[model samples]
Target: MSLHCPSPATMPPADLPAPAPHTPIEDLQALITGCLFVALSILMLRESRLLTGGTTGLSFLIHYLSGWRLGLVMFLVNLPFYAFGLAALGKRFTFKTFCAVGTLSLFTELIPGLVHFDRLDPVFAAVMGGLLAGIGILILMRHGASLGGSGVLAIYLQKTRGWRAGSVQMSVDVLILSLGLLVISPGEVGLSILSAAALNLVIGINHRPDRYFGF
Candidate 1:
């Protein structure tokens, strides 16, 4: 008779615990907080007459050019993307995205009345606004929601082609900001680029698919 035991070096590694699934209540809380942060960022940018990137930036440009409400323009701009979201991301993702977009639209409209900034420096606005928006977007992404527009496209591309969403978004934003050069001052364009970098850096660092498995 012989007894055998596996050596410590040959022992199998233990499995890591899976992340907990998000509850409906957790999703609702994240949605509200995310929208609030994004709305606040938009308010700061509006006050400073600064532009950002993505569909939100496009909304700001339209608002400046047409004197339309930013919230209304943002909501409208995101509408066309829902079809793509539904087709590519399925029902639950699209529904959460729709809720997120609608909540952001309403919050952007309402925040103006609740908060007022007498003087906002362009540099401060650009940096802080970008950070806040990035955090908001991170929260949305973790919960499987998005702000729509290019975000939908980014997610679709990432899923289909194994691309990084942050990289996709940054490329689109660069093009959009280039167009912004025609309407906004060159100085503001530079600041807008800085803001875009800040926003994308957050996504690039924290939103990697390999690292985050919640969504």
Candidate 2:
């Protein structure tokens, strides 16, 4: 059965079931599922030569400018953020974030060879990629993990300080996409904004504290 958390203002009845920690199996599947969605979204964005938000977008910029492997760049770029996650979010969260980052990097490397799209429309790719990314991120967050970088900070602020994760992420996303003008075309940047909007909208609307009551 699905577990919907009670509102913060509402007290559970005496016999209400206590929230249980996610099983290792559940976390593993969630990591795989979440990363796969993000991996596919990355492929779509790469095909369209579009930018995304977060360190992923920064990695894309470096990849474009240096002609380096995106997976490697992505993994490296997210490295320092793990330390911050560990300090701010604790061990399990940081460990899962680390694993999530590695798995996403690996998926980004492998998915391209396995899946091919002959003619992916740019607009659809932008929106669909954003939607997939949002869903993926939501899965990771609910499972007590994140993609590192701004994601870690966003979650930290949300949990400790009551800031909206989506808002924090959205602000950073705008700056990163704005910086995209240095590498990508204005038109692509505009589309990237649409993608960011689709992404942040999902988080803004759904990632509330009372939505889930588990770590």
Candidate 3:
């Protein structure tokens, strides 16, 4: 009680604590799943020419216009969104998303060379692609990794403006699909919309917090 300490103003500022590092196991699992989902999505989408939402959807749109690899376009397009993610979602999320997006891109490029289906049916492709993409998305969500396309914007909007990620993502997807009306017929656009709807349904239901815990 007698001793007097230095004034609070004179004291040095406390060093900020570092963030908890993600385990290698966690990172590895996320990467694997992300890549798998992206690859499968490409396979499915290529068969049906259907578009999903997010950066991937944009990638598909560009691919449709240019006959380029959707996977490559997906990776390239999402590169810019990483910065937004880092600023809004923090380092851990940014890193995970980066890893997921990069892995997915690489897989997209590599899968085509390695795998091919002989008799491709558009309907089967659409449904399976939606399922694979949905499953892949679920994996990334569980591990805190994102594809980092529209998702980056969605996250930012949710944090800063209190918007819903699902709604933001859906809107972007719809816009992307609308562009298909020019190149693809109304029937194809309808199918594309259906594929996207299926993808969203899977992500929404499986990714619920209370239902599927334990990352």
Question: lDDT, candidate 3, residue 8?
Answer: 23
Residue 191 CA displacement from its true place in model 3, Å: 1.5
* Residue 180 CA displacement from its true place in model 3, Å: 1.4
By summed lDDT, the worst window of 10 consecutive residues in model 3 runs over: 1-10
Better of 1 and 3 by lDDT: 1
Cα distance off (Å), candidate 2, residue 50: 0.8
Q: Write the per-residue lDDT of candidate 2 for residues 99-205, one digit (tens) a residue.
A: 98999999999999999999999999999998889888888877877788777777667778999866887687778888899999999999888887777677656
For candidate 1, write residues 111-189 as lDDT tens digits. Answer: 9999999888999999888888888888887787878888677767777898876688768777888888878898998
Worst 10 residues of 2 by lDDT: 1-10
lDDT of 3 by residue, 1-215 (tens): 00001112322334634335458897797779667875877776776667766677778778889998766787789888888778787898788777777788788788878777888777777777777787777777656666777767876787789998667766777787888787777877877777766676787676554444434
RMSD of 3: 11.4
TM-score of each: 0.85, 0.85, 0.83
The 0-to-1 C-alpha lDDT of every candidate, in the order given, reads 0.79, 0.81, 0.70
Using lDDT as the measure, the top candidate is: 2
What is candidate 1's CA lDDT for residue 7?
18
